[model samples]
Target chain A: MALPPYAGPLETTWYYGFRFLCACIFIFLITPILVIIPLSFNVEPYFTFTEGMLAFDPDSYSLRWYRDFVNNTQWRHSVENSFIIAISSTILATFLGTMAALGLSKSHMPYRSLMMGLLISPMIVPLIISAAGMYFFYSNIGLDQTYLGIILAHTALGTPFVVITVTATLVGFDHSLTRASANLGASPTVTFFKVIMPLILPGVISGALFAFVTSFDEVVVVLFLAGFEQRTIPRQMWSGIREQISPTILAVATILVMFSVVLLAALELLRRRNNRLRGIV
Target chain B: MANEIIGGDVVLAADGTPLKASLNKAMRKNRIRALLLVTPLFLFIVFSFLIPIVEMTFRSVDNWQVGTLMPKTTTALAGWDGKALPDEPVFAALIQDLQAGAKAREIGKVGTRLNYEKSGLRGMITRSGKKSLKVKEGPYKEKILKMHKKWKDLETWTVIKRNTAPYTMGYYLNAVDMKYDKSGEIVMRDENRRIYGKLFLRTFAISMAITLICVMLAYPIAYLLATLPLRYSNLLMIFVLLPFWTSLLVRTTAWIVMLQSQGVLNDLFVFFGLVSDDNRLQLIYNLTGTIVAMTHILLPFMVLPLYSVMKTISPSYMCAALSLGANPMVAFIRVYMPQTLSGIVAGSILVFILSIGYYITPALVGGTDGTLISNQIAYHMQKSLNWGLAGALGALLLSSVLALYLIYNKIVGVDNMRFG
Candidate 1:
C-alpha cells in the first residue's frame, strides 16, 4: 500500500537511488562480519596483510588458526563452561517459562497483562542491576562463583525469552483439543502429557533453544558474577577483545556464527517436523 | 432444528444428554490445567527472582546495623538537629555513639556509603565526621579544631551531626539529588553542580529520537514487503532475520569496524573518488553513529510487526476506493495506511522501549556523546559501588517503562501483541 512519490525522472531516480542505497548499506553493514569467515582461512598472522605478499608466492588459505584454537586450553575451557551453562539454563528456563505461559493464557486470571509484564521485566530490566543484586545475594546462598551460581543467574535471565516464545505459540493453539481429550475419559495429567504437550512442544523446544542461546551469548551479567575459571565464551571473548585486538577473536567469532547457524537450522528442522510429532503424540 | 441435528454431539442423540457431570468435569480439568501450567512460573518468581529483589529493596531503606544495636540512641538522634553546635549532653551521647558506631563499624560506614549514593556526600561526610569526632578533654571547641579544622563552621558541624543521626533521610534523599539540613529539611544542592535531572532528560530525548528514526526507515520497506510478491518478500524477510541470528557482539563489532577511521566504509568512499584521500569522515565516537547503527539493528524490529499487520489487509479496500474515482494516492492514503496504524503504534512503542534501555549500542557507537541513562546506571553499579543510586535510577526506568506499557496495553491491547 505504499504510495509512489511521482512519475518524474528526478523523483523516480531519487527513489530508485534510495532503495539501492538501502540494499547496498545492508550489504555493506554485513561485510565486516562476513570478512572474518574468509579471513579465518588466511595463512597470515596480521589481519590486513597476507604471508604470501611477503613471500612473493601465490596466496593460500588453510586451517592453521582452527587447528590452534582446537588445541588451546583457554578456548577449550571457555567452550566447556558455555555448554554447561547453556544446557542447564535452557532446561530450567523452558520448564518454568512454558508452565507460566500456559497458566497466564487461561480464561480467568487477575491482571494477566500486568502479570506478563512483571514476569518479562527481567528481560527489560537493565541486567547490570540484576547481576549486581545476584553478586550480593548469591554470596550468602553459597552459590556465588560456582557453576550453580551462573546457572541460576542465567536461568533467571533466560526464562523471559522462553515464556515469550511459548506464549506466542499458545495463541494459535486449538483449546478444544484439550477439552476433547478430557471428555474422552483421560485424566488431566494424562491429557496434558498425551495431548496438550504434543501440540505446543515445538514452541517449548524452540523456547528452550532460544534460552540456550540467550545464556550462551550473555556477557555483561557474566562479567559481574562469573569467576575467571568459570567464565563463559562471551565473557572470555570480551576479555580477549579488551586486552588484545587478536586475530584469534575473529576466528572465534566466525566459529561462533557457524555454531549458532547450525543450532538454528536444527531448531528449524524440528519446527518443520512439528506436525509429525503432533500426530505421533 | 436441522442445523442442530447436523452439529449434534456424537456421544448422545436422544434430545442430547443433560451432561452436567461432563461439563463440571471439563471445568475441573481446565482449572487443573491452568494451575499445572502456571505453577512453574510462580515458583520461579518466588525463589529465583522475587526473593533477591526483595532483599535489595529491604537493604535500601534499612539502618540494619543501627537497628540491631543502640536502638534508643538512633531513635533520639533522629529527632535532633545540628544547628549552632550541640550542647554537652549531645556530645556525651555522641561520644558513646561514635565509640559504639566504630566498635561495630556501622555509623560512619552508612554515612560514607550514603556519600556514594550522592556525589556531594563525600565532602559532606568527611567534614561532618571530623567536626563530630569526640573530644576526650575539656575545651571541646579547640579539641574539635585540633581533630579537624573545618569543624569550626557551625554549617559544617551541622552537616556532620545531621549525617550522624542513625535514622535519617541520608540515602534515599541523596538518590534523588536532594540533601538534608541540620533541621532535617530536604533541600536541593547548589545550582552550579545540578546534574541528575539534566541526565534524566537527555536520556529520554535520545531514546525518542532513535525510535523515530527507526520507524521512518522501516515503514517504506515494510510496506514494500507486504505488497510485493512472495518470492521477493521472502528474500527480504531472510535478510531481516539474518541480523537476529548473529551475535550481538559481532553486530556491534561490525559497526565499530565499518565506522573506524581505516575501515571499509571510508575506503569505499575514497576508492569511488567521491571523497579525497585522507578525508576525515567522522562516523563513530558520536551520537550520529549511535543513532545510525542502533537504528540499523532495531529496524527489523519495526518492520516485522508492520509487515504482519499489512499482510492481513485486503487490497480491495484501496481498489474499491480507486474505482469510485478517488485518486490512487488518496485511496491508498485513506484506506491502506489507516489499516497499518496498529502496526505503526506497536512498532513505535516497542522500538522506543527497547532503545531506551539499550546500553551496548550507545556505549560502542555513541562513545562519549551516546551515553544514555542506562550507561550511568551501569557506571553507578560498577564503578561507584553505589547500589542505592543505581537502584533508584533502575526503579525510575521501570516506572516509566511500566507506565508507557500500560498505556500501550490499553490503547493497542497487549493481547494482540505479535512477534513475542
Candidate 2:
C-alpha cells in the first residue's frame, strides 16, 4: 500500500518503521534456509565460513561434502528408499483420497462430517502418538520394520491432504456438466474422464505433490516402523545429525532446500491454474 | 423434473414405476454409490489408523505379565490377606509357578513388569525363579523367604496380588507421577521421581511461548503481505512458503548450523565484538535453541491463516475509524485488530497444538532442560522398552490434542484448512 502523504512527521516515521519491521520478520522467516547453502560448500568442514571463502577464494570452497553424500552407500540406499516409499504411498493416497473426496463432496453423502473427521484424523493427530500406536499394532501383526507397513502408514497420513484439496476443488465444480454428458448418452466413466478429470486435474496433481512431500519428509513413523533395511532419507539424516556432526548433512540440507523450492514453485503454478479454471484469477 | 406429476395427478417412469417411487429409488442409489466409494478409505483408516491408537490406549492398562506367567501363585495369593505374608500352600504354589516360568524363560517378563511397581522386585522374582527350580520339597515358605529378603516384606505380596488382574492401572499411575505406597493407597511419587508431571507442564509452557512469539512475529508480516500490492506480495510469500515446503529435519539442521557456538550467528556476534571469541554464546542444545528453531519452523502456520483473514478485511474499516477522529493506533487496535482475532486464535491454536507434540526438532536441539513430553514418550518406546508407560503418556497427550482439535474444528472448520 502507498503511504498517505499526511503532513505529520510522526506518521511519516511510522510508515518506514513499519516496513522495516516487516522486512526484518521476512528475513527471520527465510535466513535459516538460505544460510545452509553457503555453509555446505565450506572446505574446512565447519559450519562457519572460512576467511578465504569470505574473501571470495575459490580454494576455500569444495564439493567434497556433496561427494561424500553421493559416495556413501547408506545415503544412496536411503534416497532410493525415500523415493520408493514416497511414490508408492502417493499413488495409493491419491487414488483412495480422490475417490473418497468425490463421494464426500456430494450432497447425498451420508455422515459427511463424521466421515471426513475419521479420514483426516491421521493428519491432525500428533505424529509421535500415531507412530507409537502403529509400532505396537504393526508389531503384533508382524508388519513392523517392513516397507509395506511404512508405506501404508504414510498413505494413511497423506490421504487427508488429498481429501481436503480435491474436495476444495470440487466445491467450484458444476454438476450440470456431468448431467449434460449423461444426457448426451456418455457413460459415467466417460463423463469422469472427458468432463471432470480435466477440470480437477490441477487439484489432484497438487494433492499428489502434497502426499509425496509428506511421505518424503516424514521421519517419526519411519523411526518407529523402519529397521536398517528400510531407512528413508529423513531417517538417515536423523542418525547423521545425532551420531555425527558433519558438513555432509549440511550438504544434504542444501539439496533439500532446493528440492523444496521446486515443490513450492510447482504448487504455486497449480494453485494459479486451479484459480484460473474456476475463473477466480 | 422427470418425476413431476402433471394435472392428471399421476406420473410414471418408462419402466411403469410411480414417479415418486422412482425418484426415491434414484436418490437411494446415489446415496449408496457415494457410500460405496467412501467405504474403502474409511475401512482402511479404521484398521490402519484408528484401531492402532485404540490398541495403544488399551495397552496402558493391559496387564498380562504377572497373571499369565505366574498363574498358580496368582490364584494362591487370591485367598491370602495382603496385610501379611502367606502360608506354606501359597509358598508351594509360588515355587511351582516360578519353576515353570523359569523353564519357559518367561519369568524375566514378570520381573520387569513387577519392577515397575516396586524396586528390587525384578531381581527377587528372577533370582527366586532360578533358585526355586532347585528346591524340590516341602516347607517352602522359609526357603523362599531366605532366597530373597524382599519376599519377607509384606509389600512384595501386595504388589503381586495387585497385579493379578487382567488389567492394572499401575502404568497409568506411574505416568501421572503417582504410585501405590506400602499401604496400597495411591500417593504422589517421591519428589525426585516425579518427572512426567514436570515434563507435561514444560511441554505446555514451551508450546505457549512459541505460540505467543509466532503471533508477535507473524502479525506484522502477514499484515504487510495482505496489504501490499499483488506483485510484491507474491514475491514476498515465497519466504513463507519455502520454509513450509522444506523438510522438517532440514530446517532443524539449518538451525543447528546457524545457532551452534562455532556457527554463523555466534561468529557474527564475535565479529561485531558483541562477545569475545573465548565466550561464544551457547545458543544450540537448550531451551533457547528449541524455541528459536520451533518458532522459525511454525511461523508459516501463523502467517498463512492470518494473511488469508487479513486479505478479506477491507481497508475501509480502518479508514472509517481514522476519519471519525480516532488516532491511527486506536483505530487499528479497535477495528483492525478485532477483525483479525479469528485469525489470531486459529493460528495460535494450530501452532500450540503442533508445538506441544513436536519431537524431532526438540530431540535434536533441546537438551535435558528443553525436551518435551513427546521426547520422553519416544525414549520410553525406544530405549526404556516401557511401551505401557509410553502408551499412557501418549493417551494423555492425545486427549489434550483432541480437545484442542475439536475447538479448532469449531472455530476454523477443518474443511477450510489450506496448504501452500
Candidate 3:
C-alpha cells in the first residue's frame, strides 16, 4: 500500500498513523513472549531487569534457574507426570477420536450433527464445571487421587481436539480410494493401512499433537482430580504462581515456550503437507 | 396371460437376491459399521464425562444426607405441625437421632448440610450431639430447649423439615443469592452473604470488556494483514501465531513480570520521569491486570477469524465505491465493515465464551475483587468443601456456555473452526 502521488496530506497522515497503530498492536502481541526469554536468564531474583543487566554486564545472567528447574525433585516429578499423562491420553484420544471421525464422515451415520455436538461438548463446557462434576463423581467411584483418574480425565478432554482435527482432514479425503482398493480384492484392513493411512496420516499426527498439548497444558481438572503424587507441569506452575513467584518458573516457562515452538513448527509443516496433498496450494 | 406376466415381474441380482433386499442389506451393513466405529468413544465419553456431569446436577438437588442420618426423627417430624416447635415425640426422636449420629460420627455432616439454609444450625447440632448422651430420661423437649435455646425457634424446625425431604432446592436457591426464609418462603440473602450473583455479573462485565478490547486491538491488524501483500502478511503472522502457540502460563508470567508495580513497565515510566519512584501505579493483582493479560492472550482468537473472513473479501469493492464518488471513509464503513460483521460476531462470541470460563489468568493476577465466578467455584470445591453449592454454580455456568455454543454452531458452523 504505497501512497498515490495525488493523495491529500490528510490521507498520507492517516495512512502513516494507521501503520504505526498496527505496529504497536503487533508489539503488544509479541513483546510479552520475547521479554520472558531474557528475564528467565537474569541472575537477579527480581522479575524486572537489574541495573547490571541494563549495563551489559555478563555477570547479570546465569543458568542457575534452569539448573534449579532440573535439580528440584518437585519439578522433575511434575515433568515426569506431565509426560506420562500427556502421552497416554494422546494415544487413547487419537485412537478413539480417529475411529469416531471415521464413523462420523460416513453418510450412513445417524444423527450426525447431534453426535458431533455430544463428542465436542467437553471442549465447549467450562473447565471449572467439568472439574467440579468430575471431582464429586470420580471421588464417589474411588478414582480421584489416582494416576488413572487424571489420565482418563485428560483423555476425555483431549478427544475433542483429535475429533475436530481428524474430521477436518477427512473432509478433503477421497472416499473412492478405499472403494477402489477394495474392488481390487484388498481386505478392509489392508485398504485402510495402504490407501487411507497414507492420505490422512498428517491430520492424525497433527491431531495427536493437539491432544498431547491439551493434556500437557491442562491444569484445572488436574487440580481437582490429581493428588500430590500426580501433579503435572501446569499444576506445579499454578501452585508456584499462587503461593510464590520464582525465577525457576520463568525458566520452566521458557522451556515450555520452546517446546510449543517445536510443536507449532510441526503443525505448520503438517498443515502445508495437507494442503498440498489436497491440491489447495 | 398379460395379467400373469405383469404380476410375476421382479428385479434380481447376479446372486439371485432381489435388488431391493440386497441394497437394504448393504445399507444396514454400512450403518452397523459406522455405529460400531463410534460406539467405543461414545460409551467412553458417556461413562467418563456425561454421566459425571449429570450426576453433578443430581447432587445439587440430592439432599438426602440429613434425612438419612436422622431417619427416626424425619419420620416423626413428618406427622408434626409446623405452627410451633414439635412435641415431645419429635424431641425424643431428635435426641435419639443425635445420640445415634454422634455414635456413628456422622452428626457433623448433617449439621453442615442444614447450615446452608439456616445459619448457626451446625454449632447447635454439633453441641447437642455431644450433650445428648448426658440426657437419658423423659421430658426431652424441655431438656433440649434448655440445652440449646435455638431449639425453641420455629425457624430451625422449618429448615430441618425442608431439608429432611429426599430432594431440596436449597443449594440452587443459594446459588442465585436467595434462600428459604422463615415461613418457608424464598427470600434474598443478606448483603454480606450475597456473592454469587455479584460474581456472575462481574464475570459477564469483565468478559465483555475483554471482548471489546480484543476487537479494538485486532481489527486494524487483521485489516492490515488482509490487505497487505502475501509475503508481508505471512511474515507479520508470526507475531500472532507465536503467542497462540506459547504456553498460557508463560504469557501470564510475562504479564506479571511486566505489569507488577516494581516491574519493567513501571521502571520504564520512572526512568522517563512519567511518575515519581515513590508512587508506582498498582497495575497487577487487580482488574486492570486481568483485562490486559486476557486481551493479550485472546487477541489471536479475534484476529485469525477476522483475517480469514477478510481474506475472502476482495479490495475491488472499496475501490469501486471510492471511484463512484464516495469518500474512502464512507466507502469503508458502508462496504468493507458490513462484510466483516460475521467475522466480528464470531470472534467476539468466541472470545467472550472463553473469557467467561477463564480460571488461570484471573486466579494468578485477579486478587480478591478481580476474581470471577470460576474462581469462586474452585474455592468452594477446594476450600469450603461445599460440593452441592459448587455443583449448582457449575450447572449454571455450563448451561450458559452450552447455550452460546449451540448458537455459535448454528451461525458459524463448528466444522469451519480452524487453528493456526
Candidate 4:
C-alpha cells in the first residue's frame, strides 16, 4: 500500500523500514536455493565461488558436475527408480483417494469426519513413526526391500493430498447438474464421465501432482523399506550428503529445483483452471 | 400426480408404497453406496498404515522371547522365589529349555531381549544354551553354574524371572532411560547411560526454537504479502512457494552448501572481513545448522496460514484505532496483532509439530549435539536393531504429536489445512 500524502516522517520511516525487513526475509527464504544454481556450475569442485567466477571469467564455469550426474549409473538408476515408484504410487493414491473423497463429500457418508481423519493420518503422523511401523510390518509380510512395498508405502502416504484436494473441489460442486443428467436419462457411469469427471479433473490432476511430488521427495520410508535396488533420488541424495559432499549433489539439487518449478507451475495452472470452472475468477 | 398422491395424511408413490418410506429407502441406498465407495480405501489404510503403527506400538511391550523361547524354564521359575538362585528342579527345566532353544536356533532373540534389561545376559543365555546341550545327566546346577558365573548371581535369575511374563515394561523403561535395579525397584539409569531423557528435552527445545524463529521471520513477510497488491504479492509468494515445492533433500543440500565451514556463508563473511580467513566459523553439522536449515524449510508453513488469515483481516481496524488518538505503532500492536493471533497459534503449532518429528535435516546437518528424537529412533531401528526401544520411542513421540494435532484440529480444523 502507498502512504497517504498526510503521513508523518515517522510513519514514512516505518513503512520503508518494514519493506526493508520483508526484503531481507525474502532474501533469507530464497538465497540458499538460488545460490546453488550458479555454484553447481563451478569448474572447480567447490561450494563457494572462485575469484574467476566472481569476475565473470568463462573458464570458471563448466558442465562437469551435470556430466558426472548423467554418467553415474547409480544416479541414473535412482532417477529411473524414483519415477517408477512415484508414478505407480501416484496412480494408486489418486484412484483410491478420489473415490474416497467423492464419498466423503457426500452428506450421507457415515462417519465422514472420522473417515477423513483416518484417511489423512498418513500425512499427519510423523514420517519416522510411519517408516518404523511399516518396516516391521512389511518385514513380517516379506514385503520389505521390495518395489511393491515402497510403492505401497508411498501410495498410503500420498492418498491424503489427493483426498484433500479432490474433496476441496467437491465443496463448491453443484449437485443439480448430476441430478439433471440423471433426469435426462443418462446412466450413472455415463453422467460421471460426461459431467463429474470434467468438473473435478483439475482437482484430481493437481492432487496427482501433489502425490507425485510427495512420493518423489520422500526418503524416510524409502530408507527403511528400500534396499540398494530400490534407491530413489532422495535416498541417493541422503547418502550423497551424508557420505560424500560433492558438486554432483549440487547439480542434482539444481535439477530438482527446476523440476519443482515445473510442478509448481502445473499446480498453479490447475488452481487457476479450477477457479475458472467454478466461476470465481 | 399419481407418483405421489396425498391420502389420509400419507402420500403414496405409483407403486403404492408411502412416499416417506420410499424416500427413506432411497436415502438408505445412497448412504450405502457412499459407504461402499469409502470402504476400499478405509480397509486399505487400516491394513497398511494403521495396523502397522498399532503393531509397532505393541512391540514396545510384546515380551514374547523369554516366555515363549524358554517356556520350560518360565514354568519352573513360577514356583521359585527371587531371593536366591533356583533349586535342582529349576536347573533341570532350564537345561531342557536351553537344549530346545539352542536346537531351534531361536534363543538369540531371548538373549537380545534380556540384554536390554541387564548386560551380559545375552552371552550368558547363548553360552548356557550351547553348554546345556552337552549335559546328559543330573546335577545340572553345578554344570550350568560352571558354564557361566552369571548363573550363580541372583540378579540373573531375577532378570529372567521378571521377563518370564508374556509382557514387560522393560523396553519402555529402557526407552526413558530407567531400568530395574538388582533388587527389582525401578530407578533412573546411571548418569552416563542416560540419553533418551536429554534427547527428548533437546528435541522439544529445538522444535520450540524453530517454531518461535519461524513466527518471527514469517510474520512480517506474511503481513507484507497480505497487504501488498495481488500481482506483487503473488510474485513475492513464489519466494515462499519455491522452497515449499522443492524437494526436501534439495533444500537441505542447499543449506549444506551454504552453511558448511568453507561454504558460501563463510566465504561471504570472510570477504566482508567479518572474521580471519584462517579460522572459518563452524556452522553446519551443529545446532546452528539445524535451527537455520529447519527454520528455512518450515518457514513457508508458518507464512501460508498467517497470510491466509491476515488477508481476511480488514485494515480498517487499525485505521480506526489510529483515528481514535492512538499512535501508529500502538494501534497496530493493539488492533492488528490481536486479530492475527489465531494465525500465529495455527502456524506455531504446525511448525512445532513438524520440527518435533523432523529427522532428515537434523541427521544430515546436526552433528552429535543437535540431532532430535527421530534420529535416535532411526538409530535404534537400523543400527542397534533394537526394535522394541525404537517402537517405544516412536510411540512416545507419536502420542505427543497426536495430542498436539488434536489441539490443532480444535483450533485450525484439519479440513481447512491447505498446502502451497
Candidate 5:
C-alpha cells in the first residue's frame, strides 16, 4: 500500500517493519534453495563458503559433483528407474482417474461422494501405512520387490491427483456441447474425442504432470515395495544421505530443484490455458 | 405432436410410450453409464489400496500362529484350570504338539510370535520342542519341567494359554504401552520398556508446534500477498509455490546443508565470532532440526489456504474499521482476524495431520529423541521383523489422521483442496 503523508511515525514504522518481516520470511523460504545452487558448484567438498569462493575466485568452483552424479552407475540406474516408474504410473493413473472424474462429474452419478472419498484416500492416508499395507499384501500375492508392484503401488498413490485435477477442470465444462454432438448423430466415443477431449486436454496433461511428479518424488512406498534393482532417485538419495554426506547429493538436489522449476512453469502455463479455455481470464 | 393421457395419471409422448417411463429409463441408463465408468477405478482401488489396509488392520489383532501350530495342545489346555499350572493331560498334549511342531519345523514361527508377549518364551519353546521329541511316554509334566526351568513358571503357561485363542488384543495392548503382567492382569509396561505412548505424545506435540510456527510465519506473508497489487502478489507467489513444488527430499536436504554442525550456518556464526569453531552448535539430527525443516516444508500448506481465504477478504473492511476510530491493531484482530478463521483452522488441521504422519523429513533428521511414532512403526516393520506390532501402530496412526481428514472435509470441502 502507498503510504499517506499524514501518517505518523508509528504507522510508518509498523508498515515498514511488517514489510521487512515479510521480506525476511520470503528470504527464509528461498535462501535454502538458492544456497544449494552455489554450494553444489564449490570446488571443495564442503557445504559452506570457502575463502576462495567468498573471494569470487574462479578456482573455487568445479563440476566434479555434477560429473560424479552423471557418471555413477547407481545414479544412472536410479534416474532410469525414476522415469520408468513415474511415466508408467502416470499413464495408468491418468487413464483410470480421467474416466473416474468424468463419471464423478456427471450429475446422474450415484454415490459420487463416497466413490470420490475412496478414490482420493490414497493421497490422504499416510504413505508409511499405505506402504506397510502394500508390503504385506503384495508379498502375499508374490508382487513385492517386483517392478510391477512398485509401479502399481505408485499408480494407486498418483491417481488422486489426477482425479482432483481432472474433476476441477470438468467443473467448468459445458455439457451441452457434448449433447449437441451426440444429437448430430455422432457416437459417444467420437463425440468424446472431437468435442470433449480438445477442451479438457490441458487439464488432463496437467493432471498427468501432477501424477508424474507424485510418483517421481515419492520414496516411502518405493522404500517398501522396490527391490535394489528398482531404486529411484529419491530412494538413492535417502541412502546416500544416511550413509554418507557428500556434495554429490547437493548437486543432484540442485538438478531436481531445476526440474521442479520446469514442472512449476509447465503447471502455471497449463493453469493459464485452462482459465482461458473456461473464459475465466 | 400428441400429448396423450394414457392412464389416469400417465402422460404419453408422441411415440405412444409413457413420458414418465421414458424418463425413468433414460435416467437409469445414465446412472448405469456413470457407474460403469467408475467401476474399473473403484475396483482397482479397493483391491490395491483398501483391501491391503484392511488386511493390515486385521493383522494387528490376528493371533492364529500359535493356535495353528499347537492345535491339540490348545484344545487340551482349554480344559485345564489356570491354578498351579495344568494337569498331566495338558502336559501330555503339549509334548505331543511340540514333537509334531518340531517335525514340521513350524515351532519357530510359534516361538517368534509368542516372543512379542514374553521375551524369553522363544528360547523355552524351541528348547521344549527339541526335548519333547525325546520323550515317548506319559508323565510328561516332570520331563517338560526338567527340560527347561522356564517351564516351571506359571506366567509362561498363562501367556501361552492366552495366546492360544485365535484372536487376541495383545498386539494392540503392546502398541499403547500396556501388556499382561505375571498374574494375567493388564498393566502398563515397566518404565524402561515404555516407548510408544511417549512417542505418540511427542509426535502430537511436535506436530502442533510446527503448525503454530507455520501459521505465525505464513500469516504475514499471506497478508502481504493478499494486500499487494496483483502484479506484485503474483510475483511474490513464486517464493511460496517454488518450495511447494520442490521435492520434499530436496527441501530437507537444503535444511541439512544449512543447519548441520559444520555447515554454512555454523561456519557463518564462527566467522562472525558468534561461537568458536571448536564448539559448533549441534543443530541437526535432533528436534530443532526437525522443527526447522518441517516448518519450511509445511509453510506453503499454511500459506496457500490462508492466501486463498485472505484473497476473498475485502480491503474496505479494514479501512472502514480504521475510519471508525478503532486502532489498526484492534481492528485487525477483532474485525479482520475472524474472517480468516476458516483458513486458519483448515490450514492448521492439514499441517497437523501431515506433520503427525511425517516420515521422510523426520527420518532423515530426527535422531532417536526427535523421531515420531511412524518411525517406530517402520522400525518394527523392517528392523525388528514385528509385523503385528507395526500393524497395530499403523492402525492407530491411520485412525487419528483419518479422523482429522474427515473433520477437514467437513469444514473445508475436499474438492476445494488445491495444490500448485
Candidate 6:
C-alpha cells in the first residue's frame, strides 16, 4: 500500500500534478454551491459574471423575489407544514430509534444481527418500492391521505438513522459507569436517565436533527402518501417546480441553503464536542 | 485475594475459574443479552419493512393469475407441452383461460400504469383476441399463428398454464433482463429485447461512476477540514452542508437552468470569451448532467465518512514519519494514506450503494438516456402495473446491495465504521 517517495524534480512534479488535479476537482465541486449565493443577489438573475460589475445595488439587489416567496400562500403553507411535520417526526424517530438502540445494546439479546439488519433494511431498500409498499399498506389500514400517515411513514424512514447514530455512541459507552451508579443504590431507571442519557446526548440530538432534515427534505414518499392538507415542503416545492413559474422559488431556495448551513454547523459543533469529551481528538 | 480466588467464593465461581478464562466466559454469557436488547428493532423491522418487501417479492414468483381461476385448466395445463402445436380443444380452452384470467383480476391489470414505462406486454395481453381472428385455415398451425406469434412460442404457453408455481424463477431471471428459453433454462436476452437491459446496466454504471467521482472530490475537502484550524474548518464545513436544506428539486432545477442551451453557463461562456457569442454546450438532459447533479447531491455522503476517518488519524503519526526523515508527501503516502483507507473504503461503499437506487436526479437531469435501474422498477410498479416484474427487479436490487454490504463489511469491519 506504500508509494514511491517524492525524491527529485520528476517525482515532485508528478506528485504535485496529481495533487493539483485533486485540488482542482475539489474546488470545482464546491464552486457550484457558492455560485448560487452571489447569483441570488445578482443584477441579472443569470449566473454569469458581468465584467466590472460587483456589489449589491437597490436596482440589482431586488427584494421583490424574497417578498414574493414570503407572500405566496402555497410556499407559506408548505413551510408551515414542513416545520410541523419535521418537528413531530423528529420527536417520534428520536425517541423510538434511541430506545430501540438501547434495547439492542443489551448483550443478552438473542437476535441482534437479524434485528440490526431489519432496522436498517428500510434504508437499504429503494425508496420507490417502499413508497409502493407503504401506499398499499397505509391505504388498507385507512391511514392514507392524513398527516399522521405521513408522520408514521417519515418516522419509519428516519428511525434507522437515529438507531445508527445512537448505537454508534453507545458502542463507546462504558458499562462500568451504569454498574457503579447501580451499586451506589440508584435504581436502573434513574441511572439510565442521569448517567447514560447525558453521555449519549449528542448522538440523540444529532439523530433528532437528522430526522428533522430527512422529513423536511423527503419528497418521493410524501408525494405518494400525502393529501392536500398533509403536503410537506419538499412535496410543495416539487409541485412549484413542475407546474408553476416563479422567481420566488429562487429566493426560497437561497433561504433553505442558508438554513441548512446553520443547522449543519451546529450539528458539527455537537459532534466535535462529543469527540472531545470521549478523548478521541 | 489469591486465596479467595482459589476458595471458589461468590466472585470466583460467578466469574468461573482460572482454568476457564473468566473474562471470556463472561463475554460469552453477555452476548445473548446483546441479542435480546436488539429484538424489538427486529420485530418493528419485520412488520414495517421486511414483511411488505417479502410479500411483494413473493408476488413475483406466485402464479396468482392461474391459481385464482379455472383451477381445472390450471391442473390440465400444468404439464401441457408445446410440441406439434396446442390441440384444437386446448386452443379453445386457452380462449376460455384468457377470459378467466381477466375475470380473476390478473391479466390486463396494473402494468401500463406509468407514463415513462413501455407497456408493450400489457397492451399485447389486454388487446389480444378481442375479436377472434378469421384465419384462412388450410393449415391449423398457421391459423393459430395468425392470432399471435408470441402464443406460438412454447415459453409463453408454459408461463400462462402454470399453477401457483411459487418456485418459478422466471421473475428472478427477467429481473436481470435474462429469461428462460423454451427448454426452461436461463439465457441472455433475445437480440430484439436489448435496450431495456442495457438501460439498467447504463444506470447502474453511471451511478457507480458518480459515486467514485463524489469520493474523489469530497475526500480532500474532508481531509482539509479534519486537519485544518477549527475556525476556517467550521466555515468550510458550513458551505459543505449548505445545500441539504436547499430543496433537491431546487438544486436540480438550478442545474437545469444553468446547463440549458441559453442558460447561465452559456451566458458565462460568451461573457468570458471562451466561445462564440451564440454557441452553447450541451449539458442538461444527458448522462453527464445526471452524473454532475447526483455527485453534487451525494458529496456529503462521501465527505462525512472520509472526515470521520481522517479525524481519527493522530497528527502525531504524520509528525513522527516526518521526524524520521520522510518528506511530507512520502510520509502522507506511506503512513497517512493507509490509515485513511478505512475511511475511503467506507465512503466509497456508502456512496456506491446509495447511488444504485437513485431515481429523481437521473429522471430530471438525464432524461430518457440517464434513467437508472430504479426508474424502470418505478415504471413497472406505477405505469405498466407489472407489480410482478417490479417486485422481481426490487429483489434483484436488494440482493446486489446486500452482497455489496457484505463485501464492505469484510473489507472494513462494519461495526468499526461510524456512519456520521
Q: Which rank order by DockQ, best down to worst?
A: 2, 4, 5, 3, 1, 6
**For candidate 3 chain B, which ten residues in a row score worst on lDDT?**
B1-10
Alpha-carbon DockQ of candidate 5: 0.84
Clashing pairs in 3: none
What CA root-mean-square deviation does each model show from the true structure? 5.4, 1.3, 2.5, 1.4, 1.5, 5.8
lDDT by residue (tens digit), candidate 5, A100-165? 999999999998888899999999899999999999999999998888999999999999998998
Off by over 4 Å in 4: none
Candidate 1 lDDT over residue span B1-420, tens digit each: 222232344443235643554555667887776776776676776576667766654445554433344344455455566446555555455455655655554656645554443445445434445545454555543444454444455654445444444344555565566776545567886666556656677778887887887777777777777887877886676566666666777666666656766555666677788777778588887887787778777877888888888899888888799789997568868888899998888888888877777776676677787777778877877787766666666666656776777777776665565442
- Estimate, for each residue in B213-239, the C-alpha lDDT of model 2 and write its tens digit: 999999999999999999999999999
* TM-score of each candidate structure, all chains considered together: 0.84, 0.98, 0.97, 0.98, 0.98, 0.82
DockQ of each: 0.40, 0.89, 0.82, 0.87, 0.84, 0.39
For model 3, how does the per-residue alpha-carbon lDDT over A80-180 read when each residue is reduced to its tens digit? Answer: 99999999999999999999999998999999999999998888988888888898889989999999999999999999888888899899888889988
Q: Please identify model 2 stretches exceeding 4 Å from their true place.
A: B1-14
**Local accuracy of candidate 3 as per-residue lDDT tens digits, B325-374:** 99989999999999999999999989999999999899999888778989
The Cα error of candidate 5 at residue B184, in Å, is 1.7
* Tens digit per residue, CA lDDT, model 6, B47-156: 66667677777767765444554454555566567454566656555556555655655554422221112224445555553423332233444444555556566655
Q: Tens digits of per-residue lDDT for model 5 on B254-372?
A: 99999999888998899899999899999999999999999999999999999999999988999999999999899999999999999999999999999999999999998877789
Flag the better candidate by lDDT, 3 or 6. 3
- Best model per DockQ: 2
TM-score of 4: 0.98
Q: Is 5 or 6 the stronger prediction by TM-score? A: 5
Residue A193 lDDT (model 5): 96
Candidate 1 global lDDT: 0.69
B1-420: candidate 4 lDDT, tens digit per residue = 345877787888777888988888989999998998898899999999999999999999889999998898899999987887899999999999899999999888999999998899999999988888889998988889998999999999999999999888888888788999989999999999999988999999999999999999999999999999999999999999999999999999999889888888999899899988998999989999999999999999999999999999998888789789999889888889999999999999999999999999999999988899999999999999998899999999999999999999999888888888
